[model samples]
Target: MPAYSDAPLPVGLDALVGMGMNRVKLAIAVALAEHGGCLSTPELIAALGEGVAGTTIARNLNELEDHGYVTGDVPRDERRRRRTHWTLNHANLHADLRALIQATTPSGEPPTVTG
Candidate 1:
């Protein structure tokens, strides 16, 4: 399990800048958000459907954690050798996205890209 910063943000915004808003990272974020925060690598792969390798899932999880969008905890099962569990940091996700958009847009101007 990995650790992440304690923060609040939306999943979409986090995925956007956290992983450069790439498709795979966005998918991972959606999976966690849809599941209400908390999913193992295998679970994410399963949710993403087949063809997603373990390494790919691992990479995405790590990336999310690095960006403070997700946090990991020890597995409840003691029998499980590898401690693996993750929770979404909604605060960070929302904050990051807001910051990203604000930083990119001019002051007092409507977001041209959105409308």
Candidate 2:
């Protein structure tokens, strides 16, 4: 996947804030949706940029998980780093969420891999 850009989210973060949505959570969802696979906390932090504190992202990820918007897993092997890998939960309101994201984006499409 392409590196997450420092570019503001498609609708602009401020716009999302005005919409009364949790920006970090939505951003996390967007990142996971774009990745099309699991993303570790570190990867998410990097993707989201240095401006957002890791603690803040971690907290938001837990909230997203609790809300069933995302799921997280930890590697079982002792050799591997015990990082939680997160993925968007397609079983939930995925389409609606995607539509919400797409509506804010200029392309009117869910985030693409090429981005």
In lDDT terms, which candidate is top?
1
Q: For each candidate in the order shown, give its overall lDDT on alpha carbons.
A: 0.72, 0.67
Q: Write the per-residue lDDT of candidate 2 for residues 1-115, one digit (tens) a residue.
A: 8795455554423323322357888788788878885688889898899889988987787666666667778533431456788887754644444545666567654564221
Regions of model 2 farther than 4 Å from truth = 1-20, 75-81, 95-115
User: What is the clash count of model 2?
Assistant: 0
Candidate 1 wrongly placed segments (more than 4 Å): 1-18, 75-83, 110-115
Tell me, by TM-score, which candidate is best.
1
**RMSD of candidates 1 onward, in order:** 7.9, 11.4
Per residue, candidate 1 scores C-alpha lDDT tens digits across 20-109 of 566777788889989978887668788898867777777777787778878878633342567477888877777666667766778789
| Count of clashing residue pairs in every prediction | 13, 0
